[model samples]
Target: MDARRQGIVEVAARLLRERGAAAVTIRAVAQEAGMQAPTIYRFFEDKDALLDAVAEHVFATYVAGKAQSAGDLDPVADLRAGWHTHVGFGLANGALFALLSDPARTRPSPAAEAGAAVLRARVHRVAAAGRLRVPEALAVELIRAAGTGVVLTLLDTPPEDRDPALAEEMLEAVLRTILHDAAPVPRDDATALAVAFRAVVPTLPTLTPGERSLLTEWLSR
Candidate 1:
């Protein structure tokens, strides 16, 4: 993006943070950006377009920091790091986070999708390590739901009353559901192994398509 467009987005984002969604009008952004409303229109078609741009800008900034801080020494550790970062970001940017979390907004912005993609990759790593006890997509969804729900719950509570361990506890609860526990008993180990194999079935090249499909159906049953 050009400097002028970037400037517009930055100004709008500031207004959004300071005054919430209703404050981010084109005229208001134009005044903040020191540009005319028509000039703002030249860059964005309407208020929703401008808000989407602001979301993308804010989300990209947050995710860029996450990408830098995320390391691969251990996939499970990396996943936990990501969960903490997500919860922190949402708490820090409540307005923008609300925009992204609203289910009424059926179509996710690019930044939201980018964040989901990062989570998907992390879950894939866990699956490849044979630590995941559910399908990769299901694990991703569970984590996403848990993180978002935890953030929203905290946001609704008074800061003085908020439990510091709520985020960690929620993450652990979801992890128990999606991950294989260490040193399981024989019967539990069998179930975990089956789940892990089902997760990797799509990548097995040795099996014919029909055989793969049959195995998948049986495993699902």
Candidate 2:
């Protein structure tokens, strides 16, 4: 993007941060960017385009920072770190989160998909370590559903009345449902073994593609 287009997006994101999405009109963005309304039109076909760009611009920065901070901690510990980061980002960016989360939306944004990819990576590690109790996709959904609800509920509450421990409490509850207390090895639990086996099926040595697919099909069931 040119300096002018980037400037317009930055100004619109600033408006969202300061005054929420309703303040991000083309005329308002133009006034803030020191350009005319037609200039914003040249960069964005309509209000929805401009607001979507603003949402991407603001969220991609937070997602980039989270991606960069991934480190050498234990996978489970790292997963907890990710949960805290996600909750913090949601609380700190209520308007952008609201816009990105659009309750009526049929699909997720590219930016949201990027964030979900990060969570899936984390769950994959836990499964690879033989600690995941559910299928990887199911674990991802559990965390995501709980995390979004926790953040949105907290955001809807007055800060003075909000429960400081709600986010962590909910994370623990979801983790308990989806993870084993330790990596169970050849234990009596068929489900955990199947989940862990499914995690490694993609890399199983010397199996034909069909064989791998067939094995995974049974394990996933």
Candidate 3:
């Protein structure tokens, strides 16, 4: 957690992302951190240990940064704010994103559980508030899976080619899939949007860094 240790982890992640994990040796990480290889060995036992640390550091940084921008509104807004951060962070840090997403890395880390807890709480709150009609646990799973699908689809396209129209197309597809019923139910506090947004936001991750930025901007405004 010290500056030098943190720096080493970050430099290692950059290397792991730029090169593959195999390419990130102690010597390489130390070189990037401008420290001697022995210094790294003091903090990390071996390549595997360092790799684990790097993975943890990346997820922690991401989650911490995201928690900052999440405004303390209702559960629906909280869910949307978090999704936007997740998608944006994933897009901008795709290499780190892919690495952390590997099941091997996640199995040993608490990061995944932390995210799950946040999702569970969000879903539970929305359901309790009557903003979401689905069961809390089921809602969390459904929203997470749906959101992952949306993000993966958007990320499959090149970022440079991602325009607003393309984004709108994706959003519309997502809306249709989740909000399949047309009949009106009693609206929630934020009007129809409270219902619509809650139904949609938790099911998707932030698809791009731009979307994440938009959420932060919205929070600020």
Candidate 4:
């Protein structure tokens, strides 16, 4: 990408993180990026277009980084690793995670959809290798949803209820819902699952668009 285009995306991302999506106007982004609104138009079709680009920018960074680090062997291990990364990243980046789970932003941008395609491919690979009866789309959706749910739940739990055992139980329950029919499923795998465990859950506060926007600024920095 050109410097100007990248600048627009970065500025938009920061604004979204600091001001919520509602505050991320093209003119505002242009001003933040030290460019004219027309200059932003050179890279984006409109404000919606720019929002999508920002979403893609964040999501692609994650997907690319994971791809570089992931090993293709052991479908189950790959699945676990992917889940671990998802949950870990979400918890660690509470603001970004909340932004991602926002119902308003749920419709992924083209870039985010492309990243999701990569996730779908991995799901298919695991299902094929295991000869699991899961539909590719359903598996992909379930995996993503389950991971998000786990993070959200953790973020919602009371401090007193954050016992390690409780966290483990919650994560296991989530996986059981999806892998309920898997024959010869290993109990150890279920027990060792990261998303299923409760001890280190995130427990983020209720977030607003402003908080998420702040996260964007923090992330950009």
Candidate 5:
């Protein structure tokens, strides 16, 4: 990115932090960045474009910090740490979280995709460690869904009335659904057994491709 463009994004992001999304107008960003409002058009086509850039700039810094924090921790430990950090970040930045989660947006921002990539990498590590019960993709979606839901629900509640255990409990629930050491399935948990069996169907040498597919389809139902 050009230095001027990066500077604009940083300035916009700061405004978004100190104020809200409405504060990141092109004119405001240009003023903060020490440029004319018209000059912002050289980098961003419009206000929406500038906001998208601001979102990317802020989230990319967050993702970088998350990636850096991974050290000697095991895959599961690292995953938990990442989850806590994600929840905290979302709670701390309500405006950015709402902007990134906007369904009206035509598509995900580049930095949003980068954040997902970081989660995917962590889930992949768990899969590689043989500690993941569900497929990596499914596990990622479950965590993503749960984390987003948890944050939004908390944000909606009055802080005085919010349940302190909600986020932690949600994470544990998702972990149990996806991890190898999940709470044991009840003897009558046919659905749980089916899902577990479905995961190993491809490794069953005795089953032909067609048979595996059929079994997988049935289990998915």
Candidate 6:
């Protein structure tokens, strides 16, 4: 990224933290960055673009910290750690979190995709260990949805009225729904087969490249 563009994003992110999304005007960011409003246009198409860039910058930084903190412990424990980190981040950075969670965004930003990829890898580990009771994709979706929902709910509540255990309860509920008891017993279910196939899809040489791609897509569903 260009220095000027990065500078603008940094200023915009700070503004977002200081004031809410409604205050992140292009003119305000440009003024904070010691540049003209028109200069901001050279780097960003519009205020929405600029806000998206700010969201990307902030989220990427948070996810980087999350990656650094993650360790190769038990896969399930690692996933729990990820869940805690995600909720904590959302609570601390409410504006950036809300921007990333906006339903109107439609297409996800690169940072959002990177975060999802991290979760997918963690879920895949659970599946590979034969501990996932649900399809890997489904488990990822459930966890993502639950975590986001919990954060949003907490953000909406008065701090004093918030349930301290809400986040943990939601996480444990999802875990019970998606994880197996004991060591993964041999299961012949379709979901299990799909998850196991997805784990090794990259190494399947029996199928042609196009076939493998198609199969992988199908299994992901």
Question: What does each candidate score in C-alpha RMSD?
Answer: 2.6, 1.7, 11.9, 15.7, 4.6, 2.5
By the TM-score metric, which is better: model 3 or model 5?
5
* Residue 182 Cα positional deviation in candidate 1, in Å, after optimal superposition: 1.9
Per-residue accuracy of model 4 over 85-119 as CA lDDT, tens digit each: 77666655555567657787536667556656766
lDDT string, candidate 2, 139-165, tens digits: 999999998899999999998999999
Model 6 scores worst on lDDT over the 10 consecutive residues at: 181-190
Best by TM-score: 2
Q: What are the runs in model 6 whose C-alpha is more than 4 Å off?
A: 69-71, 186-190, 204-221
Q: Tell me the tens digit of each residue's lDDT in model 3 across 1-221.
A: 78888888889988977887777899988888888999999998888788778767777877666555444766666766676676676667666555556666525546656666777766555644555544345556766666555566666778776653543354444434433233343554244334434444444575576775565345223
lDDT of 4: 0.62
> What TM-score fits each model?
0.86, 0.93, 0.63, 0.65, 0.77, 0.87
Clashing pairs in 6: none
lDDT of 6 at 188: 61
| lDDT of each residue in 1-221, candidate 5, tens digit only | 99999888888888888898879888888888888999999888998888888887778778998888665588889999999999998988888998888888886888778889888878866665556666667999999999999998998888899898999999999998888673343346565566556656777999888998998888777
> In order, what lDDT does every prediction score?
0.85, 0.88, 0.63, 0.62, 0.82, 0.86
Q: Rank candidates by TM-score, best first.
A: 2, 6, 1, 5, 4, 3
Ranking by lDDT: 2, 6, 1, 5, 3, 4
**TM-score, model 5 to reference:** 0.77
lDDT of 6 by residue, 1-221 (tens): 99999999999999999898988998898889998899999999988888889888888877787666555778888899999989999999998889889998856777888899888888887887777877877899999999999999999998999999999999999999988764563566667667766777888778899999999899878
Model 5 lDDT, full chain set: 0.82
lDDT of 2 at 108: 62
Badly placed stretches (over 4 Å) of model 4 are 69-71, 92-100, 105-107, 131-133, 153-171, 178-221
